[model samples]
Target: MTELDKKINQHFGGKVVRKDLTKLVKGNAIVPTYVLEYLLGQYCATDDEETIYQGVETVKNIISKHFVHRDEAQMIKSTVREKGTHRIIDKIAVKLNDRKDQYEASFANLGLNKIPIGDSVIKEHKKLLSSGVWCILSLAYYPSDEKDASPWIIENIKPIQVSNVDIDEYKDIRKKFSKEEWIDLLMQSIGLNPKEFTLRSKLLQLTRLVPFVENNYNLIELGPKGTGKSHIYSEMSPHGILISGGEVSKAKLFVNNSSGEIGLVGYWDVVAYDEFAGKTKKSDRGLVDIMKNYMANKSFSRGTQVYGASASMVFVGNTDHSVPHMIKHSNLFDALPKDYYDTAFLDRMHAYVPGWEVQKLRNEMFSSDYGFIVDYLAEILKGLRKDDKTNEYAKYFKLSDSITTRDKTSIAKTFAGLLKVIYPHGELNEQEAKELLDFSIENRKRVKQQLQKMDETFEEVDFSYERISDGKRTVIETLEVLEYGVPATKKTLISDESSVKSEGKNVAEDVPFELEGGQKIIRDNQKGISYDMLLGAYLIGATDIKIIDPYVRLPYQLRNFMEFAKLVTEKKEPGVEVKLHLVTNNNEDYVENAKEAFEQMAYSLEALGILFSYEFDENIHDRSIIMNNDWKIILGRGLDIWQKTGAGTILTNMCKNNDCAKHVK
Candidate 1:
């Protein structure tokens, strides 16, 4: 077992299971992951090989016998009728039969209805009244002679979730894992390989959990699709519900005035709206107004009654346009439905997760190692909802007075949620606190900055914080504003000065250059810079160039290296050879493929009188280009800095236009 596996097994013991085991036992089963994990948690939540093998067989047999498949529903029903009594797994929803003066149940895939259910079961599982719950039910087949009489009689029912979690034991075990270990554990639990993501990317993944832990937290993520924006809400937690954006209504989300019944917000810890961004999609203005009020005040009025709910709201959708295009031609909220595009509604959002920063979901990103059973972790987050640690950062840093109360509140809530996710022990040093604080400030600032482009009345505020230790102030800017050109705002002078200072560069006639102690900061989706502009001055008179970046194995990355080679060849003497050595990690699955591609490229480069060679170094993480001329340049995202585009498109060339690629520093 790996060290992580050993540590998880030691600390969590039977409460954890290997994440891959769920997929192994879940063959052709159309149930949600939580249901599969719940069954695995019961029988296979251990590291012992023999016991796990036995548990796997037992779980497989149970699923094959009981789990209902729509295609085999008739066969299963026939089996139940032949056996007289049988247990089955299906999504069962219950409703009050006002005419019969009793509660009735419906099996979603089994094509059965009006199965008499008792008041006790309805009271125990209230969720059945709304969307429904997956449950294991025992049924008896009683053939009736009467035409209207139903044959399937309910015997016993159990919801597919842990009955209870020992919160105290969970907290004690959490203390055993260090902060980094805990972060990795959470990432693995979410089915992501922690090693593949940077600290910022990992934090972005964890930020998706904020709504689960923070009450009434309002979050939105708008970017290209396939980033798993709604995955967590749909599969990871039983306490959260994911609904389609277009399907939601005032009656379903808030309260039904006719029935006087509360909606999803009153039941689930989180109510996430999927596909929330579509300009032409229709939406009710009344629902948007109620959502805005609830997002800000945590309460909404329905006729004479005022209802309050603690469920956090999350909106996840795909943006058709790139971040730069939206920023230049329209506001970031451009893709949102007209009613939801209101400035007041946007202002109520606590944080806008930069979905563009999150990498697309790749198969290699999934973990094969052990992680906390997601249901168990979900319970822990739910338990932590009552704890208020928003003021923890205040002990080490102070927000700028220019930040409004609403802005501070949003920042504080985001910071607190992240702290709880990463540091459940409530302990963090100054630097760690600063990292989270700055991240929180930047996310809120993204919302505020975009608000300025949409509404002229909103003032630009300095999103900076002061460290209490030495009273040092650090300015925070949205990654978009820094990388892209400054937004055309009335406060252009102040924005320009802050942008220059933030990059640690001296501005001379619109050209920015690094001063003695300054370093360039590149923002995602920013444009207008080329490889020649970035590295030309440093590469002058350099004969031998060495590039070290482990991720140069991908096709796009290798293409980027070749493009950089073009720059080198353009600067070199006609016949003089400039040796370029590449040091990158050998991706085990693609090593042979990468080597072949590199060899072909090397053969091509030989014709240009540029000697190119490559080697694999497993220990390399930092990306840099070191020249024999003593000029070393560091890269944040390495050479593959351009956004992915359609093949054969003009934008395929990185240097074709300044805006063709993402910002690189």
Candidate 2:
């Protein structure tokens, strides 16, 4: 086995089984995802393929012989009627029919419902019924030919629990696996190869599965189409049900007002809405309203009574405009239907997974390393929902007072999900904790920022906090504050390779960023940095600062940087070098080659007669780059900081430095 396979085996060996894979691997009899995974748990939980195959056949045999299908549902019923007994394999969900003394059971896929179950089924299966656990039931369907078809058979309806492949014991094993081996193993789990995706991208790719292990999570991802946004919710779990727009209703979701029938949310752990975004896609206003309440409060109203549910709500939609366009024009909610623009419903969202951040779907991202059979993970997540692990991170670090309680809850939910998914053993080293925390804050912050753009009335609150070594409380304005160790991110991005995507890309453009070296530009400090630094102290009150940066193919980045300089030096004396020198990178590949050309361009800076020269170096084999005088720009990756370069990129301003400002005749 590969090293990653070893680590994966060590960590997740007994915890999960990939039941969806059984058919492909062994051509064994097809079975429900939950049942196959359950049987695999007994013999194939190890990383050994030999054992997995053996286990696959074993599970298939169990299903083929024991599991019942719809075509035979009546046959089994007849057999029971004739013999006065029957034993059949199937999954059963029981509901307490308080109106009567018995529990009503439904056999999913068997086309059976409201069957009055034996008292023994009610007593022994009460917890599983209330929670709706997945089980392989030996049901005896009987009807008397006279009064009943026949007598019922008796047998144990055993519930199978798939132990997750053990991930906890594999901690040390992880250190030995090269990123490649680790990736390949993960790919193998998903039945893919590592060569198809980069390690960072692979992890980013895995983030979607996290919700399987987290209950009541609300995550939204919006970007260009074909990023596989609905892949997991649509295919990953038997317990997860995906509903197209037309499939959703009061009866299908929450509680049915008609017969008091509980809906999808009552039965499934995750209920997702596919093709969720549309300017005019009509939906029951009542559904959305109650959904909003249930999402936030986890309870739905029936008449005057409230019923609790734990289903996580997932909404998947396609956007016509790109992320940059939306950020420049309306913010993240730009493409959302008018009704969904409600801040009240949006606020309940835990994180906005920047769908735009992900690249278009690639064939190589699937993992082969053993991952938890999504159903097993679902059960674990549901089990954890009963526990309050949200505040576990808070004990080590606290949120700034500026963040609202709602923000805290959203962040905590995201954080709690991460903890359960990757660190369920609770052995998070400090680095691990921060990764989860930073991710949590960003998701909450994304929702908050979009809210502000939609309606500026919403106050901007910091979603970050500081952890003082001295144990003193420090309130930070943004995540930057938390990363820099001194209640700020000022010294962070430069020193920390992990801090690049701080706050977000669009908002950061307005801020003065201290590039690699200590050369600080006074940009928009409103969000990230000080305007004083991005713009020299002298330019503040000045009418204009002649800005020049040739490589700003992304109209937003260049102009925003220039205008930021103007904002910092707005009060500068006239004719000062307040005139900016953004010595452009003239190559047609400016955006791609922009960073490479910075060093060559930096050499041309002395003649620009500008105090500040924004260098674009896409290539230079060094950690250090020169700045005029004592100031030098030191970057982790140099000018090749951002991923793309395009003229229409969202960088807007009011002066020549601003985007459209220069276009005006």
Candidate 3:
């Protein structure tokens, strides 16, 4: 096992199972992931290889013997009749039969209904009253001759979930893992491999869990298909239910006035609408109005009475156009039906997830390591719903007053949900708090930005915050704004001397820029930035330049190095040859190739009136560029800031050495 897997097992023993085990024992059994994992947690929640192997067989046997498959329902019923009683796993829902004054149960897969169940069982698991709950139970078959008697009986029913959890213990054990490790553990618990995602991408995945943990949190995600946007609501938790978008009505979702029975909102923690996007899809105006009210106020009225519910609403759908295309031609909500496209209805949404940023699922993205039995994680998240972290960021920063109360509430709920998911123990530093705060603002800002485009009445608000200690205001922008926004042409000089600095000032006169000495962090996947934008101004007046980067041996690394050299040549004087030296390292596999590439680069640059020299340094680790002008520029990712793109693409052109499309302000 990997060290992280071992550590996870060491701390969360008996509560975590190998994530891949769900698919192993789930052959032909159409069950939710929580149902399968609940069974796996019983026998396979161990890291030992032999125990896991035996447990897989044991779970498979149990599934084969008890779990009902619709194709074999008659055979299972025959077995139950012959044996007089049989145990099975199936989705069971209960409804009160007012005429008979008794509650009746329905087995979803067994195709049986109106079987009488005792009131005691209904009180024990009230969730069965609203929707079907996956349960393990025994059914007894009896031949009765009475006029209104039923032959099938439900006995000893148990919902497929952990009965209880000590939330304090969960919070206590959470302190053992660092924030990154804990995030990874949570990612694996959701059946995703964390190694395949960036920190930003990981946070995006975890944001899907906020609705499950926060009350009345309204979220929507529209993107390309196969990104697993609706998978969490369907597979990760029994507390949440995924329903077809077209299948919803006021009666099915809110309440049936005639029957006076509450709908899904009264029982489930979250109700997610799947396949919710299509411009041609028809929707009821009454249902949309009720949804807007419920999403904003957590209350809905079907009759004269007002009923409140805590269920969070989630909408996941597929977008027809690419992000840039939608941004250029229309707003992001263009795929929604005409009724749902209303600014008033969309304004109730707390956050809009950029589903386009999520990478499509690949085979290697599924986790095989140990993670929480999803039910256990679900229980913990449900327990955390009561704890509020709305004021958590106030300790470090204060938001702008221009933000509306609705926007603030949305940002707070998202921030609080993320905090509960990652730091249930309530321990956090300023940097961590800033990350969550910025992400929360960006999510809500995305919603508001689209609203502004759709409706001119909606005014733009400043989504910026100020630090309490230093009063440094930080502005937040969605990734799409940075990726697709207009190109920046000029850069403001930072030095007190506004006049030009000499050596190559005239060469870069058309593209004026400047730099100051400070550390800057660029987020991954952020595009339209080039090496020239960052180091060009700093390298303008230097006669001799030395770059110390230990990793310039790979093909991509060499490409990045050449790009930096090109930037230097662009910012050099017309006749003077600036001496450029590179101190990089080589390995056994690429040493010869590295030398050849460096020789070729030197020969090429010599003709451009720039003297290029390079040497190998095996032990040099830190990356920096030292110039003769007494300025040293440090690099965290060297010259490889630009992500690779297809040849001759717009991104490739915009991110080349001389392009200054996106600049750091």
Candidate 4:
């Protein structure tokens, strides 16, 4: 176990289980992750390898014996009948048989329906009245023959989830971990490796949890397939349900007028629609209208009766075209069905997570470390829904006046959801609050910007905030806007200075390259930057340059140095030699390799009419570049600033073969 894993075990003992165990014990059973983890939590919530191994085997045995599979339903039924009574784990939903004045249970995987159930059981687990709940129950067969009589009997049932959690204790324990550590812990709980995601990417993953904790908070994410957009809603929590986008109706989602029963929104905390995109997919216009009203008002009316529900809405889909293609030819919501393309319905969304920014899943991305069993976390989130942290940002900053009330509400709900996820204890500094505020504004801004492109009446508003401490205003922009909508004069292409319009109507050319000396604060997960755009203007006319960085001994660090050197060569006059020197820290392990690499770089650069030299400084810590042309550039991360693309290459400005701008600030 790593140090973080050990710390997690020490602080959250018996509450956290190795996340990878869920997949290990899950063979052919189609159950939510919480059910399997609940079983594992009872046995494997320990760091000891021997205990974990034993626990995994025990859980596997339980699953093999008790968990119902559709293909083996008849066999299990026979076993139950022969044994008189048998314990089984299956998804069970209850519905009131009004005519008989009794409740009936339907076992989803066991393939049994209309089994008589106790009234007390229905009262205890009311959620069973809506979508099915995974439960461990006893089934008996009486083999009786009577008019309108059923032999199947359910003796007892227990929902498969953490029964209860001391939310106060959970909040108090949260104080032990730092912000980054807590974020990593949450990431692991969702079966993701924190090391594989940038801070921005981590926030995007956490944003999916917002709908679970915030009432009526609508969210949408559309991107390329296989990004795990619907995985969280489907597998992470029993309180949420994932359904086909094209299969919903007013009666199914709102209230069933035929039976006068409350629908899914009345039971689940979140209702996520999977595969919600495709322009040609047919949809019920009445369903869309009801959804629009419910999403905006948190209530739906049936006849003259008004019903309210707090279920947040989530829509996850795949984009048919790339982000740039959508930005050029259509809007970011181009893939949404024609009925759902209305600006009014789209405006109900509180956040638009850029699923395109998320890297596709790989084997190594699954966590092997300790994290809260998701059921425990899900319950905690459900508990947090009672507390409103929407005004948390008001302590540090005020949003711009130009932001409308509805936009502010959307931003506040998103901010509150993120705060409840990251800082549940409500302890945060100004910078932390500011980060969440900016991120919140950016997400809502993405929705609004796309709305403007789709509809003409929607006026553009400045997505900026003013700090209470110094009154400094900061404007936030979505990554897509920065990549595609930059002014023509600021275009960074060296090959073609001409700027092309989105509609291919006109072009602007001959803009002079401009540079100013000031601190450039790049937001996290920002893209559309390159070595040329970052340092070319500053390094122009520099004959003698000395780069001072403390740690550049790693192979990837050396690659960054070489890329910078190549940029320098390309920028300088073809025939004139530019002298370059490096002052970096020495490492005993890689000092020999560094010397060899520097010698090879010197040999290569000398032929290009450039002088290169290097020296190790054990005591130097500052990173900067000093040039003889009276220019000094301070480096926050040295030359290794670009983020790693999923394709295993550095993403600077844009992808090598695609138009993805991926980087961390």
Among the numbered candidates, top TM-score falls to 4
Looking at model 3, residue 335 earns an lDDT score of 96
Better of 1 and 2 by lDDT: 1
**Candidate 1 deviant stretches above 4 angstroms:** 143-150, 487-516, 521-665
- What is candidate 2's local distance difference test score? 0.56
Write model 2 residue lDDT over 452-515, tens digit each, in one string: 8777799978555765443534222233222221223332322121233333243233244332
lDDT of 4 by residue, 1-665 (tens): 87889988998888899988999999888888999999999999999999999999999999999999999999999999999999999999888999999899899998899898888887788999987999998888887779878888888889998967888988898899999899999999999998888787889999999998899999999999889999999999999999999889888888999899999999999999999999999998888889999999999998999999999999999999988888888988999999999899999988999988887899988898889999989999999999899998999989999999999999999999999999999999998887788789889999999999888899979778788998876767666765566345344322101111121111122123454343443445556656665677667788998999887888888988988899889878878899999999987899999999999999999998789999998999767778876667766566767635211112222111121122212
Score candidate 1 by lDDT.
0.81
RMSD of 4: 5.5
Instruction: Count residue pairs with overlapping backbones in model 1.
Output: 0
Better of 2 and 4 by lDDT: 4
Supply candidate 4's per-residue lDDT for 406.
91
**Tens-digit lDDT track of model 1 for 1-665:** 88989999998887788888888999998888888888898889988889889999998999999999999999989999999999999988777776878888988888788898878887888887766678998988999998778888898898877757787787677788877788889999988888777667788899999999899999999988899999999989888999999999899888888778688898899999999999899999989989888998999988999999999999999888887788778877888988898999999889999998888998888888998888888888998898898999999989999999999999999999998888877878887787788789888988998899899999979788777987877787766655554433222212211122333111111233431112344333344556775566566677998988888777777788888998998988888898989999986898998999899989988899789999999998877777776556666567766535211101111111122133222
- TM-score pick, better of 2 and 4: 4
- Candidate 3 matches the true fold with a TM-score of 0.88
Count of backbone clashes for each model? 0, 78, 0, 0
Query: Whole-model lDDT, candidate 3?
Result: 0.85
Candidate 2 TM-score versus the reference: 0.63
